[model samples]
Target: MPSILGGDIDPSSWSIIQVDLSQLNIQFLILCGVAGIDLAVEVMPDWSELPYDLLVLVSRCFNLIEDFLNFGIACKSWHSVATKHNFNSELPRIPWLMLAEEEEGNSFRKIFSLSNGMILNKRIPKASRKRCMESMGWLFTVGEDDGETSLLHPFSGVQIELPHQYTTVDYYDH
Candidate 1:
């Protein structure tokens, strides 16, 4: 609605419309508010003046663009400013592997970015996961061949096998 943020609203009905705030939409709305700078540009139709006081008021309370997004849901005034912020910044990084006490019980199957700690993937590539554990720069025997073992990557089709025991450990040099 055109009367989203600052519309000289007399009734609180305008405020009630901010019930379902999607995060992406809210961010866009904040960015828009920043772009619509003249309060005169708002009130005068083809010449609404940018509400500097309102923008300042909103910006001060909205420490982050995300905060302005949340405010946009409250009323039309906030919606303008909320939609004006930028979305150039990066989000948090996700985890790479998630393990649990049981194979199918409460699990922690997610990889967050090592840079930002945002949740990334929720799977472990059996072949490469061992490599992550081996990131310490040491090769160790993982599973002994009591039965058939399949080494595989979860996201890719790469695989390997260690079928029989070797007589000498010098077969392959690290």
Candidate 2:
């Protein structure tokens, strides 16, 4: 009783909905929901105390499931759930190339992957939300005048110079 009262709030009592929640990382969601402190008071019904309410928990599970999907798409942790079938289907059959971004209104830029029409690179982690929409949404490319294009992450404001002039660990890291 003391453990339940003083320990972290836990929603593990609820089970996965058993639906096609492949888009939602159920395991990761459970971990997130368990982080807050325990409830201040436990409600009672029919003059009986319930350790946990199953109905509310089920609802919370559904909500968390939605969050999990968004979380996966926004981050790199469970991105597999988003592109799990890319290589196994028609997504990998046709290939496209990344072209250079042209004039103000021109759209001739970046290679689109054959798989899912992406840049042949996985989605950028949500941590780098401002890094580049084109990072994953569009394929990066080198064109005739594509000299050392700066990879400026709008979020961190970190600019990684493309077409590096020097070979170092930082260049290889990205």
Give the number of the best model, judged by lDDT.
1
Model 1 lDDT at residue 12 = 59
Question: In candidate 2, which residue ranges exceed 4 Å CA deviation?
Answer: 1-97, 104-111, 118-157, 161-174
Question: Which runs in model 1 stand beyond 4 Å of their true positions?
Answer: 1-108, 124-132, 135-141, 144-151, 163-174
lDDT of all predictions, in order shown? 0.44, 0.39
Clash counts per candidate, in order, are 45, 6
lDDT of 1 by residue, 29-100 (tens): 788788974434544442123485656454555434445567566656545555544322333322343332
TM-scores vs. true structure, each candidate: 0.24, 0.19
Model 2 / residue 123 / CA error / Å: 15
Q: How close is candidate 1 to the true structure, as a TM-score?
A: 0.24
